[model samples]
Target: MSDVNQASQTLLDSNPASQRIPPSVFLLTGAVAVIGSNSLVLSPIAPEVAQSLGVSVPMVMSGTAAFGLGTAASALFLARHIDRIGAWRMLRIAFMLLTASLLVSAAAPVAFVLVAAQLGAGVAAGVALPAIYASAAAIAPPGRESKTVGIVLTGWTLSLVAGVSISAVLADWLDWRAVYGAVFLLAAGAFAVLVFNGHRDKVSTEPAALPLAALTIVGVRPLLLACGAFMTAFYGVYAYLGDHLHSVLGLPISANGLVTLVYGLGFGAAAFLDSLEKRVSPRLGLPAAFLAVALVYLLMAMENGTYGAILALAFLWGLANHLGLNLLIVRLTALEPGRRGAIMGLNSAVTYLAVFAGPLGFGWLYTTAGFGALAGLAVVLMVVAILAAYAAPSTPRN
Candidate 1:
C-alpha cells in the first residue's frame, strides 16, 4: 500500500469507527468556530452593547481587553495542565465555562458584568483553543496531518465570514443580547457533540511539566519565535487595515467589510493546498510560506494608494497567511507529539501576547509614520521570522 493508504488503514485498524476525518475534523472545526466567533463578536457589537449598558464605547470595549488578559494569563499559567488532565476533559470544562460566560454576558446589566463575563470566555478560549489544536494533531491520520489541521483552522474563516457578520445583523435587527444568546446556543450545540462523539484524547502519565520546559526541546523555541513574529505582523496590519481603507481610500465601513470578506474567502480557499505541504520538507516549506507573506506585505505597502489593489492584495495576504499558520501548527506539533498540549499552550500564550502588543506597537508606527511605515514594520518582522525559520533545526520530511 502507498503511504496515504497505509496511513488510513493504520488509523482504521487502531481505532475503528471512533475517530477519523469528516466527523472528528468537523466537530473540532465547529468547536473552533464558536470560540473564534466569541473572541471577534465583541468588537463589532461594542457600540450596541455600550449603549445598552449605559456606558461609553471605550468602556464597553474593555470587555475585549479583559478577554485578552484572561486568554493570555490562562494560556500561560493554566493550559499546561491539559497534559495531566487530558485534552478531552479540558475541552469539556472549557466548553462549559464558555457557555456559562455567554449566558452571563447575555443577561449582564452593567459594563463591569459584561467585562467580567468576557474574561471568563477568554479563559475558556485559552483552554479550549490549545485543546482543540492538540486534539487535531492527536487524531489526524499519520500522513495527512497538515491537511487535517488546515481544515480545522478554517473555522477561523467561518467565524470571520459568518459569525461576526451574523452577529452584527442580529444586533441591528434584534438585540445585542440576542447575539450572545445565539453564540451561546452554538457553543452549547458543539459541547453536546463533544460529549457524545468526541474522540478520547491521550494524557501524559508523567506529571505535566511547566510550559517553559517545552522550550528545552530542540527546534521548539525558534518555531515559537517564528509563530510570535508571524502573529504580530498579521495582527498589526490587520488592526489598522480597515482604518487605512476608510481614511486613505475613502471607503465606508460597509465597504471595509468587503475587504474582510475577500480575505476570508482567500483563507478558506487556501486549505485545498494543505495536502501539498506533506510533499515538501519543512525546512523548505516553512521559509517559503514566510517569504510569500513578506512579498504580500511589500506589495501592499507599495500599492496601498489604490483601493482596487489593496482589495486584491487582501486575498493574497489571506492565502499566504493560512499556509503559514498551517505549517506552524504541523511543525510545532510534530516536534514532541506527546507534549502537544503544553507546547500548543505556549503557542496560544505567545499568540495572545501578540494580540495585545501588535496593535499598540503598530498603532504607534501608524500614527507617527503612516501606513507605509506600518507595512514596513510588518516586513521587518517577517524578515526576522524568516531568519528564525532558517535557524530552526531542520526536520526530515514526513
Candidate 2:
C-alpha cells in the first residue's frame, strides 16, 4: 500500500467503530469551543482588565499580541513533535496547558502576569491546532477532509459570536475576572471530554517522520504566501472591528458585540456552504468566496454609519474569510499528504504572523489613510488572493 493508504488504514484500525465516537464529531466540536472561547471571551474584557491591573489599555492588549507571537514561535517545532508524541497526547497536553493558563490569567494580579498566561495559552494553541487538523485529515474518510476541517473550524465562528455575546453580558454583570473564570471552567470541561475519549484508544507507536527536504520541495511556497496574505487581511479587520465600530460609528460596546455576533453568524453559515465543494469544485467555490469578500470590503468602505449596511458587510466578510481558510487547508493537505503536519505548521506560522502584524499594520493605515483607504487595501489583497486561487493547481479526485 502507498503511504497515504497506510496512514489512512492505521487511523481507521486504531479506532474501531464499536470502541470510538467518530473522531470528526468529537474533535471538531471540542476544538471549536475550546479555541474560540479563548479570544471571544477575553477581547471584551481588555479594558476592564487594564483598569483592574492599573495599567493602560494598550498594555492590557499586549496579551493578545503575546498570544499570537507565542503561537508563531512554537508552530514549527511543535509540528516536528506531533507524530512522535502521538497527536492525541499532544492535544491532551495542549488542553491541560490551556486550562492552566486560563486559570493563571484569571488569577493574575499584574498585567505582565496576564500577558505571560496568555502567551502560554498561545503556545498550547500552536500545538493543539496543527495536531487537530492533522488528526482530522488522518481519521476522516477520503473526500470528507474539507468538511471535517470546516466543522472543527466552525468552533471559531461560534466562539466569536457566542463567546462575545455571552462575555459581554458577563462583563456587564460581573467583573472581567469573572469572565476569564468562566472561560477557565469551559476549558476544564473540554479538557475532560478529550481526555475521557482519548483514553479509550491505544496510542500509535509508529515513527511518523517526514523528510524536511520533501516539505521544502512540495509546491508550498505560493500556498504559504497566500495563507499569510489572506490572514493578514482577515485578522487586520477582525482585530480592530470592535474599536472601529465604537470610534467610527459612535456605537456602544454592546452594539459592537452585536456586530461581531453577526460576523460570527456569517462564519458559521460558511461551514454549511463549505460542503458545497462536493457540488461545486473548490477551484470555482474558493474564488467565488474571495470575490464575495472583496465586495464586502467595498461595502464596508462605502458605509457611513448605516447599521444594516455594516451588519451585512460584516456577515459576508466572516463567511468569505472562513471559506477561503478551509479551502487553503484542503489545498495544502492535498498537495502533500505525508507532510500534512509540516505544511500545516508552516501554514499556522504564516497565519499567526499575519495575525500578529495585521493589527499594528492596520492601526497605522487607519491613522494615515482612514477606513476607506484601509478598505481599499483589503480589496486589493483579496483580489490578489483571487488571482492566486485561480493560479493554484486543481486537486485530482480520488
Candidate 3:
C-alpha cells in the first residue's frame, strides 16, 4: 500500500465510523473564502475604488483580469511542485502567500498596488485549488469523493453570497476598505487553524515528474472542451449580473445583493445534492442542468418578466453552473489517478483562461448588441457544453 493508503488506514482503524474531515477541507475553504470574498465585494466597490484611485471602472475591473492571468500563469508550475514536495506542505506555503497578499491588498493605497496584490492572491489560489482537489480524492472513501469535494467547495459559493451581501451592506454603512479588512481577519483566523492542527500527511513512493505527454493526449480532450465552454458561459453570466440587473431591470444598487443571494442559494442547494453522485451519474445530471439554464436565459432575453421570474432564472443559472463545475472537477480528477494533481492544475489553468475571456467578451457584446445578443450567445455555449458531456467517456469510481 502507498503512504496515503497507510495513513488513511491508520485513521480508519482509529475511528471506525466517524467521518473525518480531511485537512484539504480547511485549507481549500480558507483559500476560497478569500477569493470569493474579493470577487464579490470588489465588483460593487469598483466605482468607489476608481474614484478613490483616480481611475476608470474598466481599470478597476482590469484588476480582476490580472488576477485570473496570475492564476493561469502559476498553475502548471505549482502542479509540478506539488507532485514533488507533497500537497499538504505546498498548501501551507500557499496559505502563507495568500495571507500576505490579503494584507497587502487591504493596505494598498493605489490602484497599481491593489492590482499587484490581487495578482499574488490569484497565484496563491491557483496553487492551492488543485492540491486541495487531489488531497480530497486521495482521502475520500470510494464512491464519495465527488460529494466530499462538493462540500469543501460549497464554502466558496457561500463566500460569494455572504461576501457580496454583507459587503454591500458594509459598504453602504462604512467604506469598501472595511470589506477587505474583514476578510483579512478571516484569513488570520484560518492561518491560526492551520498552525494549531497541522496539515494531514499523505504517503506515495512514485517518482515525481511533469506529465507533458499526458497533456498532449486526446483522452482529456472532451473534458477540456467541456470545462472551457462551461466556464466561459458561467463566468460571463456571473461577472456581469450586477450590471445586467441594474441596466436592464432599472433596479437599484442594493438589488445586486438580493439577486446574488438568490443565485447563491441555488448553488448551495445543488451542492447539497451533489453528494448523491454515487447513485446518479454526472453524465445524466450535467446535461439536464445546462439545458435548464439555457431555457432560463432564453426566457430572460425574451421578456421583461416580473421580479419573481427574474430571481427564479438567476437562481437556476447559479444552480446549473455549480452542478456542472463540481461534476467536472470530480470527473477530471478521476480521469488519471496517478496524475491527479497535474490534471486538476491544467483544469484550473483552462478554467481561469475562460474566466479571463468571459467577462471581456460578454461586456463587449453587452455594450454593442444588447442583452438579447448576450443571452443568445449563452444559449449556444450551453448547447456545446451539453454535447461535450454526451461525447465524454464515462469513468467508474473505485
Candidate 4:
C-alpha cells in the first residue's frame, strides 16, 4: 500500500479506541500550540507594533478583533465542512493558510495589512483547532477523552509561556516583526509534519444535521456564556497588558515575558489537576474558578507598584483559568458527542466572539473609565458566569 493507505491502516491497526493517546496526537498538539499562539503573539508588543505600523496601540489592538471576526466566521461556516472535507485536508489547508498569513504579517508595511493578516491567521486557527479537538475525542481511549483534551490544550498553555516569553524578549532586541517571523517558521514546521503524517480524518457518521444538532444542545448555552465571559475577562487585560505594565506601571518591556512565563506556568500546571475535578461538582468547581479569576482581577487592579503582586496575581489567574476553561472544553466534547464537530465549532465561534468584543470593549473602557473600571467589569462578568454555571444543568442534551 501507499504511504497514505499505510498510515490509514496503521490507524485502524492500533486505534486509540483500544489504547492510550496515539503518538500522532503530539503532532496535532504542536499545531494547536502555534495556532493558539498566533492570536496573541503581537499582544506582548502592542505598543511597539502600533508604532511600527503608524497607529495607536488601541488601533493595533483592533487586530485582535479582526482575528476573532475571521475565526468566528470560519467556526460558523467551515466547521460543518470538516466532516464533508475530511480533517486531515482541512488541517493541511489550515497550516498553509496560517503560513501565508504569517508571511503577510511579517512583511506588512502598514497597519491595515497587518490586521488583515491577523484575520487570515484567525481563519486558519478556526478551522484547525476544533478539528483537532474532534479528532482527539474520537481517537481517545474510552475514559481518557478529557485527558486527551487536557494534553492538547496544554499546548496552548505552554505556547503562552514559551511564545510570549521568548517573543517578547526578541521583540525588544530585534523588532516587533521578528515575532511573526518566528511564528512563521514554527507554522512551516507544523505544515511539514502534516504533510508527512499522510492520514485523513474520517467524516462524521452522526444522524443529525450540523446546524440543527448544534443549535439544540442544552448544555451548550451556559457553557458558551461562561466561555464568553472567560475570554473577555482574559483578553480584556491581556490585549493591553504590555501597555499596562510599561506605560501605566512604568515597567520595562522586558517584564512582559517574565510575567507571561509566570502565568503560563500556572496554566500549564493546572492540567495535572484535571482528575481532581471528579471529586467536586463542575457547578462548584467551575464557579469557584470563575470567582477566583474575578478576585485576581480585583486585586491586580488594586495592587501597588510591585512586580511581585503582578506575578503572583497572574499565576493565580492562570491556574484558575486553566482549570475552568479546560473543564468546559472537556465537558463540551462530551456534551453532544454525536454532533461534536459542530458543537466544538460553535464553542470556538463563541470564544472568538468574546475575543472580538473583549479588546475592543476593554480598550474603550481603558480609554474612558481606566483599568480599574475594566477589572470591576470583569468581576461582574465572572459573577454572571458563576450564576450561569449554577443554573445550567450538568447533564448533556439528548
lDDT, model 2, position 12: 71
lDDT (Cα, tens digit) per residue for candidate 4, span 1-398: 89999898777657755666777778777888898668877777888888777889899888889999888888878887776677778889989999999999999899999999999988988888878888877777666776777788788776888787888898889998899899999999999989888886677564425553576777788888888888888888888777888888887777888888898899888877876866677557777777788888889778875888889988988888888776777778777676778888888888898879999989888888777778778888888888877776775311
Per-candidate RMSD vs. true structure? 4.0, 4.2, 3.7, 5.2
Which candidate comes out best when scored by TM-score? 4
Task: Output the lDDT of residue 342, model 2.
Answer: 68
Q: List the residue pairs that clash in candidate 2.
A: 32-155
Error of 2 at 94 (Å): 0.9
Model 4 TM-score is 0.92
Q: Tell me the lDDT of model 1 at 192.
A: 87
The RMSD (Cα, Å) of candidate 2 is: 4.2
| Stretches of candidate 2 exceeding 4 Å from the true structure | 1-24, 40-42, 50-58, 199-217
Residue-by-residue lDDT tens digits, candidate 3, 318-369: 7777777777777788788877877878887777777677777787887787
Candidate 1 residue lDDT tens string, 180-235: 99999999988887788747766778887875888898999998899889988887
lDDT for predicted candidate 3 compared with the true structure: 0.72
Q: After superposition, how far is residue 242 of candidate 2 from its true place, in Å?
A: 0.7
For model 1, what is the error of residue 398's alpha carbon versus the real structure, in angstroms, after optimal superposition?
3.7
Order the candidates by TM-score, highest first: 4, 3, 2, 1
